[model samples]
Target: LGERVSWQTLATVLIGLLGVLVMLRPGAGLFDWAALLSLGSAFLYGLSQLMARKISDTESSTVMAFYQNGAYLTGALLVAGLFRLAGIEHAVHPSLEFLVRPWIWPALPDLLKMAACGFVASAGMILLSQAYRLAQANRVATFEYTGIIWSPLWGFLFFAEVPHSATVLGATLIIGAGLLAFRTERLRAAPPLLVPTGDTA
Candidate 1:
């Protein structure tokens, strides 16, 4: 099934993406390969949301989330094993270390924290899947920009970190873009005004 995106929606999407770039600020010396991975991940996520829309009528959100998490677990194990087999030194880089690090028994507290994280992730996946099930992909996707605002709030609350001016500005842009997209969608969905055939002279 093909869905056509309106020009307003496309413009707002571009604005939202621009805000993401501003927040990221990738440059020659400052760029990391991980940023590209993040971009690729976003693209894949959008694709997934679109695909979810097609199947949302037939498949339940719980089923979608189950398969999604199952894939994540399988991929993680496969990548970790491949990296370990390649004999990559853990000290090579933080990313490499993450991949090649040997599994160890964790303290009860650490295990609980990890479990909490998994719970939150699973809940989020279910909610997002349900959102796609209920609405157009573009409409749901635009609201993802709200994460820019939440990230800073979370960092401030949990890490005692203060956001820089650029972060604030970028977040503002993202929020604005989301609002614009919402307005565009609402206008598109609104019924056209009915005018009387006879006009007053």
Candidate 2:
């Protein structure tokens, strides 16, 4: 769900939206800078993936998987910490003092929702790792594109946030490209060896 294209593509779209706002407003330097930073990060990630594939032949797949998982976990922790800190700084405690104050811990429902989210997230990670381990890495990674196809559908079904026609079209193109690339890589990685004349009839 997170991997495929949603995580990066969605972030890129949001940053693009911010950039639009910055363009429309005269004094939005900070937003402009932030948007550029986000765009640059996404570009670098794409380049990094290309570089990784170039070097992958030299590294054990298991080691690569470990590093990938470790990076995911580290990113998750950082995001969680950032949100938790935001909540604390906003004095979102639901104690008596908070009740007396204007800031009440967003709400009991929100807190419960966060806990449920965390549980689901942990389970998803476990399942993803298991899935990766059970299949060839390239094959598993190929299927990750399905998440890109499904994300907008999920968003529309759950939040009534209909995706743009352009988004749907773009995702379809990307999925097709991913399939083609996967097939090409698979064939190249395990090309059939030829027999010598002595072995042939």
Candidate 3:
């Protein structure tokens, strides 16, 4: 994996991470213990990508997606079981509450929405698994920063929320970094220029 990454790819990854930090703007007061959980999640995600790259040659993407979804389903069930058995008090914090909440049957409309969400998520995972199978992890990772551009667009379309200038600027940087990485990859892939060994007759 290390051997597969070039300096250009590393630079692009750093630039993409910089864009993420600029958007998040973590500060002294902004730091929260929950942020560590997010960081851990990101680390696991990167690890999974690395693992995908390692096995992609031998494993089918469908098989990868199947295992990934199975793991998620198992984890979700285990968490729900633990929450139920522990009988923990209702959490005041939204994140904690969501985690510990007991399962309940949703209304028909809500159930449909949940099903739709699951379908979309599963489809996305399958596509991502295929992408990892088809490309080097480092070469494709920078494109993940494109989420920064889509977030605000989705927010505006779905929730009528407008983004601040900082978001716009950060998205621009993220996109620029992705474009730079793609260009670098393209140039690297181009055939080397031929040099004449001797003067033509």
- Top TM-score model: 3
For model 2, residues 64-97, the per-residue Cα lDDT tens digits are 5566557867986786576665664443332313
Q: Write the per-residue lDDT of candidate 3 for residues 75-94, one digit (tens) a residue.
A: 88897787778887597565
Runs of candidate 3 with Cα error greater than 4 angstroms are 195-198
Candidate 3 lDDT at 81 equals 82
After superposition, the stretches of candidate 2 with alpha carbons farther than 4 Å from their true spots are: 1-34, 40-104, 119-150, 196-201
Clashes of 1: 0
Question: Which wins on TM-score, candidate 2 or candidate 3?
Answer: 3
Clashing pairs in 2: 92-105
Q: Following a full C-alpha superposition, what root-mean-square deviation does model 3 have from the true structure?
A: 2.0
Clashing residue pairs found in predicted model 3: none
lDDT string for model 1 (29-124, tens) is 546775576678888888887887889999999999998899889988898787778886565446545666677999999999999999999999
Candidate 1 residue spans exceeding 4 A from truth: 197-201
Local distance difference test values of all predictions, in order:
0.82, 0.54, 0.82
TM-score of each: 0.87, 0.43, 0.90
